[model samples]
Target: MTSPAPTLLRPDGSNLRVLVVDDEQMLTDLLSMALRMEGWDVKTAGSGFEALQTAREFAPDAMVLDIMMPDLDGMAVLQRLRQSGDDVPVLFLTAKDAVTDRVAGLTAGGDDYVTKPFSLEEVVARLRGLMRRAGTAHAAGAEPILRVADLSLNEDSHEVERAGTEIELTATEFELLRYLMRNQRRVVSKAQILDRVWNYDFGGRSSVVELYISYLRKKIDAGHEPLIHTVRGVGYMIKAPQ
Candidate 1:
């Protein structure tokens, strides 16, 4: 019997680069191996300072960073990068699985988080989700623009605007809004959103989906007619104001 084919997350065949930052050399090597199997250019850093240097030099498309690194924890590294105006999508790896820890990471501009002792498959799935949301993995010229009334999303440019006013959105928010706008007028179930936007069904919390929807509403629906609507006991839908 033949071994299963390696998963290709990036449909566009672009040369995607990923940086894996962890103090554990073994973990970095393992992650590098798994990521390379997907045909990504994978780089590893064993320290926060080294990770910063690599991020600046390598300019990875996405990053998997450990939160407990010595000298400069992942949050500090991310803070420094953000201070320097780098908005690269980041996924935090932490041994702490508490809600506070997850929320802190997210609040600190992480695109996603994975707990320690995670399956390689789950990590890959999360990375895929981040890449997809960051608009780094999809083919260009395919549905370049999605619109619902005054709300518009330019997939190629990763831009969102409402009523001609530019709206800044994080990668995850862009992906969530894109999904909603693509399904305009239809109430998408929370499960479907989790599967499509997050690339996971198991252990997928609906609360996260709700939080993102609220974020979208603030940006896209605030001071407007409210394009995104919640259907009681169902999910969400984007519809034009009647």
Candidate 2:
């Protein structure tokens, strides 16, 4: 028999909105109970379709998705949401414990993953970490001219350039790229980004980080060689052009 899952306390004082998606009603209930104990406003869905619908209605701050759901897998749902430009942070739950599975989930746009038979405490901890990162990324200050490598970001002008060519960025996109550049080569976790940039802690979401990274890829790396390297199981890093 499995031991009782540990309880969790919500870190930010207010009730956070969270969506828990799993086909197993028992497991979903357990997860929801754990989150509620932390003072989160929790919602559960038993299928991919329901998860999406609930996500739209609930507008949750973060989501916990089971990767092996029936009808629609977590990766598929995540891809669809990302394609639609939803930036809600997602934590995947999977029965598979293989490294490949974890990599696949991250590559498919998941912020993090928890293996099945996991302690509820572990799940909550991961979610909190993801949310914290999301908060930091948005809370970063407005500093002019963030330089990393040959790349330069003029926050005052919202101009990005490498080797002297001009690059344009949206407001949010600019901040995201600037944060990465400011850290420059450091293995800055998504949580740190959220905390520094977004200002909230343990309540925001990480999907926004991925989406903005995608934006940066299009503007900064689509035509040029890749400069952003994803450190597997760590975070993201912006390095000098080599």
**Cα lDDT listed for each candidate:** 0.86, 0.75
Cα lDDT tens digits, model 1, 1-242, are 97643344344556688999999999999999998887789999988999999999998889999999878999999999999998889999989988888889989998888998999978887887787777777643466788889888887678888889999998779989988988999999999999888765436568999899999888888899989999999999999989
| Residue lDDT tens for model 2, 1-242 | 98543332223334568899999999999999988886678999999989988998987778999999889889889988899888888999989988788879888888787788889878876776555444422212334467766678764445689778988666556667867887788988888877655433434468777777788888888766788878877789998766
Off by over 4 Å in 2: 1-14, 136-242
Question: How much lDDT does candidate 2 score?
Answer: 0.75
**Cand. 1 Cα-lDDT:** 0.86
- Candidate 1 matches the true fold with a TM-score of 0.72
RMSD of each: 4.9, 10.6
Task: Please state the error at residue 104 of candidate 2 in Å.
Answer: 0.4
For model 2 the local lDDT of residue 38 reads 66
Q: Estimate each model's TM-score.
A: 0.72, 0.54
